[model samples]
Target: MARELLPGQSPELLKALHILTRDGALNADSLRKLKQVNHLVRLLAPAIEDVLARFGDPVLVDCGAGKSYLGFVLHELFLRPAGKGSLHAVEARPELVAAAEALAARLGADRMRFERAAIDAAAPPARVHLVTALHACDTATDDALALAVRHGADHVAVVPCCQAEVARQLGEAAAPAPLLAPLFEHPWHRREFGSHLTNVVRALALRASGYAVTVTELAGWEHSLKNELILGRKVRASDRAAEDRLLGLCAAAGIRPKIVRLLFPAGAPAP
Candidate 1:
């Protein structure tokens, strides 16, 4: 148990997070959590830097921010040093929000704010430059994506978790395509296929909303099961072809109409 420090990371902040004990020691669980936060920061830093370069004081929103770990790390390593950015962490749990607020106060993270609201209901007080949701459960990831689309954020990064919507749809109805029937035959297969399909649809939805999207692993499977990371950068125009493909996929997978409506609203061109 030694003081394993990440360059540019605040040791006191880590101590406050309980990632490191007061004696500067880390156990297995804390070390794993620290690694996870480090991985997230590494993945998101370049995009944040780009925004900072373009806009002197950009705003970042974290949806479904449980403990606001990502927001805090970003504030300490990126925002605080730049002295030109804001971090808003939105969470449904009031106690967690209070905890994050207290931590931010202790760490002197004046630029950070915590909201006790769900992803869909939370309103950012300012224009958002970037939107992020790490391991947002079930349809909450969709809420984050919709929030990005609605607010016209410059960038979005989300890692979706526990996607049961598609699986439930597939289980309720007969497979729309015979080829996919085998894939949905078993409960495990249904769950796995549903998760992959959900992300694909999400990427397509972002593309349709005028964002270039990239989907990749947030970390190794050994580190986390919810590893899929969807990164999006706003572009000039929406891709109609992507929208058509998304609709087609939904039809093939027998996804519910309500979900489709959530991704593609009325004004969005239909296939």
Candidate 2:
């Protein structure tokens, strides 16, 4: 006898994703990974539904899409049910892109397409309704955010991972902020502070770009170390005060000019 399937989940889809074996059996590890992916999809479901309600045929771009697990699960659970929408999975690895493309074709996921491209270089044909970056490492997450903002995505969901940029910036600082000097004295503290500061700057940047930003734990710490989930919904007006605070934070941390320019462009108000 075969094991029971999750509601609304296709056995074929699971097998194609390799979450299930050829014999349609799942081990403990596969089940745990699937649960994690499902949890992430649930977190973004409300936002996706909102976009679908507003736009009849929504488009979603997934940056640094890796093996395209999130893209596949999202299409399976949401877009396929609606019988509309498209998902573009952008990955730098040719093999991963080819595999994803083949799997999508086999699954008859005609609306899904996999592209071989980096997050910084991906040029969407049109503005997308939603953007997602799951565990996009270091500056790749920033690249994804920049892409989303540039394309004017309606909703952005990102789970940043391995944020080394801020830590490196902190280490290169000629003079650390007086208030934060003690925290930066130790390597471990510097790593933790860098992670926190990176998220803060990112949230502020999104706010500066006219997004209502929310930061929450993506999952329990025990389950994943990279658990911070940042959700952003585009708004009509940008928050000048948040931008101002972001600038002040940068100055205090003695961030490099390049990073400042990347996060807050010139010709933007004095803030």
Query: Cα lDDT of all candidates, in order?
Result: 0.83, 0.81
Residue 224, model 1: Cα distance from true site in angstroms: 2.5
Residue 113 displacement in candidate 2 (angstroms): 1.7
What's the residue-level lDDT of 266 in candidate 2? 67
TM-score of each: 0.92, 0.91
Q: Using lDDT, give the best candidate's number.
A: 1
Output the lDDT of residue 59, model 1. Answer: 87
Which stretches in model 2 have alpha-carbon errors above 4 Å?
1-7, 256-260, 267-271
Model 2, span 154-214: residue lDDT tens: 9999998888877777887877679877877788988998888888888888998899999
**Error in Å for residue 169 of model 2:** 0.9
Estimate the TM-score for candidate 2: 0.91
What's model 1's overall lDDT? 0.83
Clashes of each: 0, 0
